[model samples]
Target: MDKASVDYTLYLVTDSTMIPANKTFLDQVSQAIDNGVTLVQLREKSLLTLDFINRAKETLQLCRKKGIPLIINDRVDVALAVDADGVHVGQDDMPATLVRKLIGPDKILGLSCGIPLEMEKAIEEGVVDYVGFGAMFPTKTKKDIKLDRFGQGPIGIRRLLRTLEKHNSSSERKIKCVAIGGINQSNAAKVLYQLNTPTQKVDGLAVVSCIMAAPDAAKATKDLIQIIHTPAPWTQALTITKEEPQSLENKIKTVTAKSPLVHHITNGVVKNFSANVTLAIGASPIMSEFGDEYEEFASTIDNICLVLNIGTPSPEMMNLFKHALQTYNKYGRMILLDPVACGATQARLNVVKELLNYGQVNVIKGNIGEISGILKLTSTYKQANGNEEEVLMKGVDSIAQLNEDDIISTGKQVSKDFKVVVVISGPINYVIHQDRYKSIPGGHPLMGTVTGTGCSLGSTIGSFIGAQADGRNKDKFDVYEAVIGAVELYNKAGREAAEEAKGSGTFMVKFIDKLFENTHNI
Candidate 1:
């Protein structure tokens, strides 16, 4: 088999033991290949040498019929006996260099890498064609291997990306990299998109149980390929505008016409304000913190959006937040997370981290302190010399005056890491969705004098996102645009409300009224 003819996009490794009692191993492999599996590996660790060779021979004939490559795993003798397309070796198996010597250069050789150092060594040695990197997530198939040896648990997507970078910098020849272990349809998109950087990314995904254990192997393979090929949601850049745009007015109308239900499980202090903000934006509001009601709301509500704020954190509230997040995920509804005062305490940070890890959050609204805390950057404050001087944040407020570059970088990193639109609140609001970022640069200073404004902004954004979910604009729905419109509208209302305000109390009252009045003409 020729190396150029092989497609590594959906690499399938066979585990005969996981095959159903009703089905033969070859039946599953044939089904997977018929659907979209580009490559296959015969991994028979427990079988006798001759038996494994015979199995490989049969599988090779099947793969050759379909024009797909069949590589034997760990057994070079079996691969050589059957004249298999190539052989895949693990770290403890025959040295890749020796395997390369045994098998001619025409065959495809893949090495399983557990960490960056191993990958670097393989590339420097230049013995293999591609690298199989994983235990991307925990898996029963490779349960015997020590996870800690691979770096943090599961060799998470972020770390895998870093390893790729290291490989690129160290090696001149380009080699394909595949993600293996515990990958499935549910997390296929995350594994493909999250483990990607501007300079480097994995060429394909390798699976054990996901393709082998699935009842419908063909459908599973097709679905995984679809996720791998789907365009990333954040590819479009965030664009900013200064004028009173027609798009903003149109989105506001959509919200009013649809009357989307904006559900809130926010802090006790901001419940009233957040609900009013939702209502002001022409969306119905529901405030509930009871975990028991989540299933009811999820089942009943049609045009729904959820807002989760972690300002006032408690164990009970955390449970409710998790419940709502999971329910909304199932319904495919947009969820807005407001990690208010996230940097103020360890408890708040822990809650924010858990929610981010558990759900596919649509948008995350936070202050500078909160966003920086979430990214785990060095906490610093601006000195009198207009420089970012290092200082630990002891309170909730932001002490450092971050420039546009700093804010944009932080926002993009957060958006990429969590696959959500990140909104950092300040006098100049910065909104980032994937690779694009928009900085809306107008708001009254007095808006900062009040509490719950940030929480309210999240509710407002939720309303706009819910309105966009009506399928009429599903393909055109860009969360960055929706959030920019929401921010511009809210900021304009704040400027208008400040014109006739006497003090903080008057400004707060006027701001809510102005938000309601402006929605009519937005």
Candidate 2:
């Protein structure tokens, strides 16, 4: 069989120890093949050489009978003895070039790559037929394997997408990638969809215990195949619905009545403003940044919503943010990220990237410059001399030239990339969730004059999200509606405050009062 003709959709790497005591290893393999597994690799490390060769021959025959390719794992001698279709080697195993030379030209060779650089090396050397990219998630199957030696540890969906991006840009020949490690029916859809961008996607899913340890291997295989092919509910494009004024008012009433706890692990610079904004919008605010206290709030607080702001980040603060985000995600709660000045420094950008990559952020709220920085867009501004100066974000301020289409496109792309609602704040606020986007177009210029308004806005959104959770409206919570309502409410309060205030200082106070008044009236 030719390597190019192989169908790797559901690659199975056999671990006989994981099979049920009642079922033979061959029986499970046959059932999985009957269901939908497209490829198989016989991996036996503890068996004696002769015993391994015998098992390889038997497995190869079974696979050939089913017209499926069986590859040997880390045992080129056994693969040669059995004349197996291929051999898969790990990073520390026989080098791909040497393996190719030993196996000769017609036989297949699969190299396990943990990082993009290794993948690049494989393509550059032109030695392997395919690459196995993983451990995409923590796996008990390969618990003893030291992943750090390979320069990656469970490269999550985001990192996997990045590795694939690097590979596509550098190599002209298409190299098939089969994702291994911790892939199961529960997370197969996410591994397939979330790991994919508009341009890059994994060609197949490689499994160990998911099928090997299953009571019903056929059913497990069938179920995994189904999930891999079907679109996750969250990934589907939702249409924007026009929200009525009455509906918005009712949502506000729910917030006041419930007063859900909105936890802010924000910067010290904006902690007071964020907490006040949360309270004024009819939500209980808890300003806590200690990682030690995260478990208490995550466990005890009801209808909890977390706001993670990177306005003043330290390694300790970033660690706390990670803890909070993981806790919220574990409880299936909402988390809003305010990436303040993410593009200002390499440290800030790295911290934000780490948070986004690790956490399942539900909402990302930032100004044009911050959002552009997070998305890595080349944003520029007009200088006093009427020349375009590349915007190097200095503080938590937006000095970039604003283009409506560019902002909208960036918002949409970021939303899709993270599978999260993105709110880009400016003169026109864009609330984007998947395909649906709405622009809330009014805010007093005085709003920008106040410090931490952006952080406060994120806090306000967190309050609404918490309220929605309390109202038992999570499944029904319209992300676009919630964002639009938050922006509209804040904008209206700013406009009212501007009318009554003499200056930015007075406007800040009036704005808080207006928020309370609006909530009370609703």
> How displaced is residue 458 in candidate 2, in Å?
0.6
lDDT of 2 by residue, 142-187 (tens): 6544343212222233454465566676777667778888777755
Q: Report the lDDT of model 2 for residue 30.
A: 88
* Residue 191 accuracy (lDDT) in model 1: 62
Model 1, runs deviating above 4 Å: 48-50, 92-94, 143-155, 162-172, 196-200, 229-251, 288-304, 310-333, 341-360, 374-392, 415-420, 433-438, 441-451, 469-475, 495-508
Instruction: Give me candidate 1's TM-score against the actual structure.
Output: 0.79
Alpha-carbon lDDT, every model: 0.75, 0.76
In candidate 2, position 461 carries an lDDT of 87
After TM-score superposition, the amount by which residue 381's alpha carbon in candidate 1 deviates from its true location, in angstroms, is: 19
- What's the lDDT of the predicted structure labeled candidate 1? 0.75
